[model samples]
Target: MEMQGEERIAARRDIVWAALNDPEILRQCIPGCQSLELKSPTELSASVKIKIGPVSASFSGDVVLSNINAPESYTISGEGKGGIAGFAKGGADVILTEDGDDTILAYEAKAEIGGKLAQLGSRLVGSSAKKLAQQFFADFNAAVSAQAAANS
Candidate 1:
């Protein structure tokens, strides 16, 4: 599946960029995230629990950041294993552009599922993925905006 969207965050570009790279911020923002540990500047290990339709699973994975252009854009990718449930892998290309005192964050993402997850039907899986993405961005925006307000 593929998805793309943009969000206008009420924060400076630099602040938004920093938050994007912060594992703590990501762990807090990502839906169902249990833990996120930075293994390197460009790598992270994460565990997330999610429910799709009637399936519930905990996924453990390593996220990698590549094609990086600091404070501008990067490609983030990861794959997770969920034991009997299945596996999920995806990547997103994120771009941040300055919009006055705020920042415009845009992303294009693509994902694939195998095993039982793929058996759930595309319509259901796609809707769930879209909802999850939206929730993540909304939470991320709120966290960044709050932090910016606190600092200023």
Candidate 2:
């Protein structure tokens, strides 16, 4: 499946960039993220629990950030294993553009699943993925906005 969208954050591009790289911020924003640990400057190990249709599983994954351009853009890729449920892998290209004191964050992402997850039908999986993506961004925006306000 493929997903893409844009959001305007009430914070500077630099701040938004920092938040993107922050493990704590990401853990808080990710829909089902239980933990996000920075393994390296551009690598993270994460655990997340999610439910899709009738499957609920806890997945452990590694995320790597590459093709980075500071305060501008980067490519994030990750894959996870969910035991009997299935496995999933995806990548996203994120771009951040400055809009006055705010930042415009855009992303294009592609994901694939196999095993039992693939058996759930595309409609169910796609809708679930979209909802999770929306929830992540909504939470992320709120967290960033709250932090920006606190800092000012």
**RMSD, one per candidate, in order:** 0.4, 0.6
> Cα deviation in Å at residue 124, candidate 2?
0.5
lDDT of 2 by residue, 44-148 (tens): 999999999999989998999999999899999999999998899999999999989989999999999998999999999999999998898889889998999
TM-score of 2: 0.98
TM-score attained by model 1:
0.99
For candidate 1, the 10 contiguous residues with the lowest summed lDDT are 111-120
Off by over 4 Å in 2: none
Candidate lDDT values, in order: 0.97, 0.94
Clashes of each: 0, 0
Tell me the tens digit of each residue's lDDT in model 1 across 15-46: 99999999999999999999999999999999
- Number of the top-ranking candidate, with TM-score as the measure: 1
